[model samples]
Target: MEAITPFLNANQQISVDIKTLREAPDFKAGEVDIDIRNVTPLFLNQEEINAHYLTTYKFRLYASQAYVEEKGIPQSIHDLDAHTLISFTKDGLFPHTYEPQAIKCKQHLIIDCPLAIANAVENNVGIGPLLPHIARLSQQSLVPILHNQLRQSLNIYYTYPASLTQNRMVQDFYNYLQSLPEDFLKGRTHLLAKRPQKINPLSDF
Candidate 1:
């Protein structure tokens, strides 16, 4: 936040309104020039914006290196069906979708929060997903489970208010956010400009 302050406050004519990525879809829902575009990942389809590509996370299964080395790595998503999955009840963090055949784990452990999920995974209660930051913090207590395929990162965006076009401060702030260090929007992985190798979110863009 401090790094971008200089840019946002450079002009005092207008104040920029910062909003979440989910709020961007409705930027121009009923207005004009309030277009919402996907600015990250430099996808092919500029029309459909995905906040996911702008973020990154580590994909891990709760298991010791010794155990995995002996059992072999999970080769497919379906392989997870045989393993217990610990997840947080918090909203918007875990991936959610309507799947008629979604498997119900043999033991669905309910944790109080995200930290609890990581704790459970560290104890080898079950394999689970976690952000890279949290994973790094908990590494000494847990094991990293590798997968045959890498997981897709999360996406985030900043929406510009339609009515603030004439405001220099607001527009400058928007441009500054657009120019934010890619790692700031996304998670730390490769260099900010280095695009992901496998999970190319821009295939639709």
Candidate 2:
């Protein structure tokens, strides 16, 4: 949402309501007025939307140097089974599961939040596939794994209601989101494996 904040701020012509669907008591298809739905690729039912598409999200995996050195890097599609899998099961299916028979299921663990999975992998609990954006933030502590077999991307959508007001602001916001820097969506882990300096703290007088 940060990526498109500028667009919303630029336009003052429309009133906006933000609601967390998870918190809504009567938030059913029949109750709420359907205006527009900006859906993420993570949606289990992309076919349900069948509307406008804005952009895509790429998913990647990260692992520890020890795991790679010991097991050897996975070189082909079937190699995912060789590593421990971490995932946030709130969405029901793994990101890569979108494709038919993409990876062989081996060891798997489900956490409640995105941060939880990221934190676990960062601490070298196991290798995990996550949004590149999240991976980038953790790169200083974690390493990316299985470069060849981990390639996949998902599309984000911006569905509009029949009566969506023709405001330049909404359109601009979508454009800004689409125009976000590539790095904002990707995590660079190769650099993390290199030598990193340790910081020491002492009591201040």
Candidate 3:
């Protein structure tokens, strides 16, 4: 959203209302200009909505240092059952397909917010899946668990009215999104891994 702020400021005519897509609001009302979602909308065939492919994000299971010390790292999927698990309350957005049912059944704590889940894991509440970008940003050092085996990915999409495809502001925002560099999202993950400093746990909130 910050990437296109300058354009929005200059245009003055274009405004954006960001909302979670899970609530199933009326996008056809003509008031909502763009709807960005982490998952694909179920009503894509509604004829009024046009979805645009944004980008794909990679995710991995992460555990706090304290949790790892206590439970030890999970060597395999079967071993995960022995450890406490942290997960999102919404099953649809769990992000892992390898062992979706198994993981869901083993959740020790169900959290609605992603940041809260990360914080809980940092505080040694449990192990959970997180995007590399989010893991790097957290104040706690999250060790990647089952990194080689439990990798997962999700695609992000933005939807708008087909009729608004020709709108200059909409086109400009879309173009700005496409202009982002390939490594732009992963740069922090790589940099953080090499740093020796520890992050303050309080800053995570």
Candidate No. with top TM-score: 3
Score every model by TM-score: 0.46, 0.58, 0.75
For model 3, what is the error of residue 191's alpha carbon versus the real structure, in angstroms, after optimal superposition?
A: 31
lDDT of 3 by residue, 45-160 (tens): 66777777767778678999888998898888788878887765545325433234544435577776666777888899888877788888788888998888767676655666
Q: Write the per-residue lDDT of candidate 2 for residues 1-205, one digit (tens) a residue.
A: 4543464466434434433332211212322222222234444254432245645666677766666666666666477576666764533324424334345557777774556777877766676766767876765445666665555566544443223235333344446645877554332110000112211100000
Alpha-carbon runs more than 4 Å astray in model 2:
8-50, 66-82, 88-93, 99-106, 139-141, 165-168, 183-205
Alpha-carbon deviation at 120 in model 1, angstroms: 3.9
Model 3 misplaced regions, further than 4 Å? 39-47, 90-100, 104-107, 182-205
CA displacement after TM-score superposition, residue 176 of candidate 3 (Å): 0.7
Which wins on TM-score, candidate 2 or candidate 3? 3
Which of the two, 1 or 2, has more lDDT? 2
Candidate 1 Cα errors over 4 Å, as ranges: 1-82, 88-93, 96-101, 110-116, 137-142, 174-183, 186-205
Clashes of 3: 0
Task: State, as a TM-score between 0 and 1, how close model 2 is to the true structure.
Answer: 0.58
Q: Candidate 3: what lDDT?
A: 0.60
Q: How accurate is candidate 1 locally (lDDT)?
A: 0.42
